[model samples]
Target: MQRKVLVIEDSAVSMNLVTRLVQQAKLMPICAATLTEAKHLFSQSNPEEFLCAVVDYHLPDAPHGEAIDYAIASFVPTIVITGRLDEETRTHVLSKEVVDYIPKENTQVYDYLSRLLARMEKNKHIGVLVVDHMRSSRTSMASLLRRHNFETFEASSAQEGLDILHQRDNVQLIVTDFKVPDMNGTQFVAELRKSWPKEQLAIIGVSSGNSALLSARFIKSGANDFLQKPYCHEEFLVRIMQNVEYIENVETIRRAANSDYLTGLPNRRHFFYSVNHVARTSPALQSVALIDLDHFKRVNDQFGHDAGDKVLKEVAKLIANHFSDHNVSRFGGEEFCLYFANVAAEEVDKSLESFRRAVRERPIRHQQQDIPISASIGVTHQGRKNLDAMLAKADELLYRAKSSGRNQLQSDLLA
Candidate 1:
């Protein structure tokens, strides 16, 4: 189901703009022009159906933020927009635990809104670690991160932070203070680099000392960025978002390079690299399978390349589902490769037989036509041979399977 976002703005122009922004983020917008309508809509929604909400501080029915209060009471993550910039207004809106307050300056309002939405969407899954021996500092930073929807973990000292890293591998960002009980911020960053690189994890150092050397030291020690103590909330958020964005972009590009664009399976290049890595790391016997679709050329000849693509996708899905735990890849057109690491010898044949039966029994439907697909598979188990030799043996057996009959399994071990 598409996620929905509630927008409560009295001004027609602002409401229209907010709706467009929500649509651009690919979220369904439930727009309310007044406080009464907003409450009615909230009453109608399922608690889990709405992702978040945006509310204007002044509405037709409730001018003093009643709409924002209602949203907060309903447990919705709210973003408030207000024309007022007084301290009292800011304090009141923030006290309600609305995600953040956006000023109605009209110059950068929508830009900040879009960024917040994007951050909230990604933040729910990204884990952040705060390392500071001072309870006050750690609590303050963790509270801010939590308000932004980031999953937070706290560590009192550098050693504790390292232990937390081992326990929670998904930690993507670390905010550490220079005055930790154990190692200082710079030293902690250096130690962390031994396991996590800049692309895999981002570190930001915060220091109360105004010395220029502090920032320089942290940056030189592999920290992605640094923060001065007593920084404004906006500045801190921007720095965190920027570093996290960089990591996300690098990861996305890496995945694109390693994955097949059409079927989202590992591409041929990644397949070779992973197989060798697994062979070197795993001691248990590994099995390699080379599978080729039998007479796949006929699908394109009969139904065109588009239909052939559909069939290949369906076949890939079948293979992935049948061998969900193994490393499976698209080894170029009409061919795929599978690597089963640390598996028993007998389990290899059993798995392949099940996959073959699934392929033969199920036909892909393209344009209301059922197109049957079958594959020839060959398996080889690692003995004293290397990965390259095992793959060669598998390919050799695959050729024999095709030569004997189109849709069959052939392995030297089975003989």
Candidate 2:
């Protein structure tokens, strides 16, 4: 079901702007011009259907943030927007348990709100760990994190935090205090850096001491960021978001570097790295297969390169779906590779035959034309020796398959 965002505003200009932003975020906008109308609309709808409520701080019917109170009371997260940038208004908005407030002074704040909406949706899958010796501190931090839809974990000691991290693989951020029974904040961060690189896990050190060097020490020890105690709600949330985004941005770059630009499959370098990692375990049986599209250059010669690219993409999709359990990759051009561990020779041969038949039967549609395609596969199921030897052997068999017949599976297994 599509989640809805309840937008209550009196100004025509602001209402239109907020509505567009909500739609751009891929959320349904439920608009109300007045507090009474908002209440009527909300009473008829399910509260669980709403992702959040964006309310005007000064409404015609309910001035002085009464609409904000109503939205919070209705169990929906509230975000306030107003032209008033005064200290009093900011304090009043912050006093309420609202998610965050946006100043309507410029267009840039609306962009921030858009990012906040996206983060709220994504945070549901991200886990955050809060480590503090005091239960009250841990609970307070966890409560604020929960409001943003983050899955939160609480640990009272450094050792407990490490244990929780080992058990839960989804944790991406850690917020720890400087004082703990087992280790201080800098020491704890140093210990964590031994295994978790900054690109994979984000850590923020918090301290209330008067020392000016605490933040620097934490950073030197591999913490991504630092927060001083008595930090405001907005500042704290911004720091957390920045660190999480840093790790996410690194991951995006790494994936682009490792994936094929044409088909979005793993490139040859990544394929070699993955197979070698698995080879260390030395399974009882292993198989390698090299697949090549038969007469692929003919398609590009008859149809344009665009049509040929479409065909390759379609075949890549089929390979992904067919061999989801095995390690699969697209070695440049029309060739692909697959690695199977711990599978018998007979079963491997049967799987390859099935895949060959599938490729021959399915025709790719391109430019209103049906482009027929087929693949020749060569498979070797010898015991583990080395990846290079197996790949060379598979290549020799692949040459034989293409020589004898175009669309066929040739394997060393006798059947």
Alpha-carbon local distance difference test for all models: 0.88, 0.92
Model 1 clashing residue pairs (backbone): none
Q: Write the per-residue lDDT of candidate 1 for residues 1-415, one digit (tens) a residue.
A: 9888999988888888888889888889999999888888878989688888999998878988999889888888888988888989887886776678888888687887887787877798999999999998999888878878899999999999999999986799999999988778899999999989999999999999979899999999999999998987767877888888899999999999999988888999998888788778866688889999999999999988999999888888888888889889999899999988888868888889888888999988999999998999999985558877988999999999999987899877787
Best by lDDT: 2
For model 2, what is the error of residue 397's alpha carbon versus the real structure, in angstroms, after optimal superposition? 1.7
- TM-score for candidate 2: 0.94
Best by TM-score: 2
TM-score of each: 0.92, 0.94
Global local distance difference test of model 1: 0.88
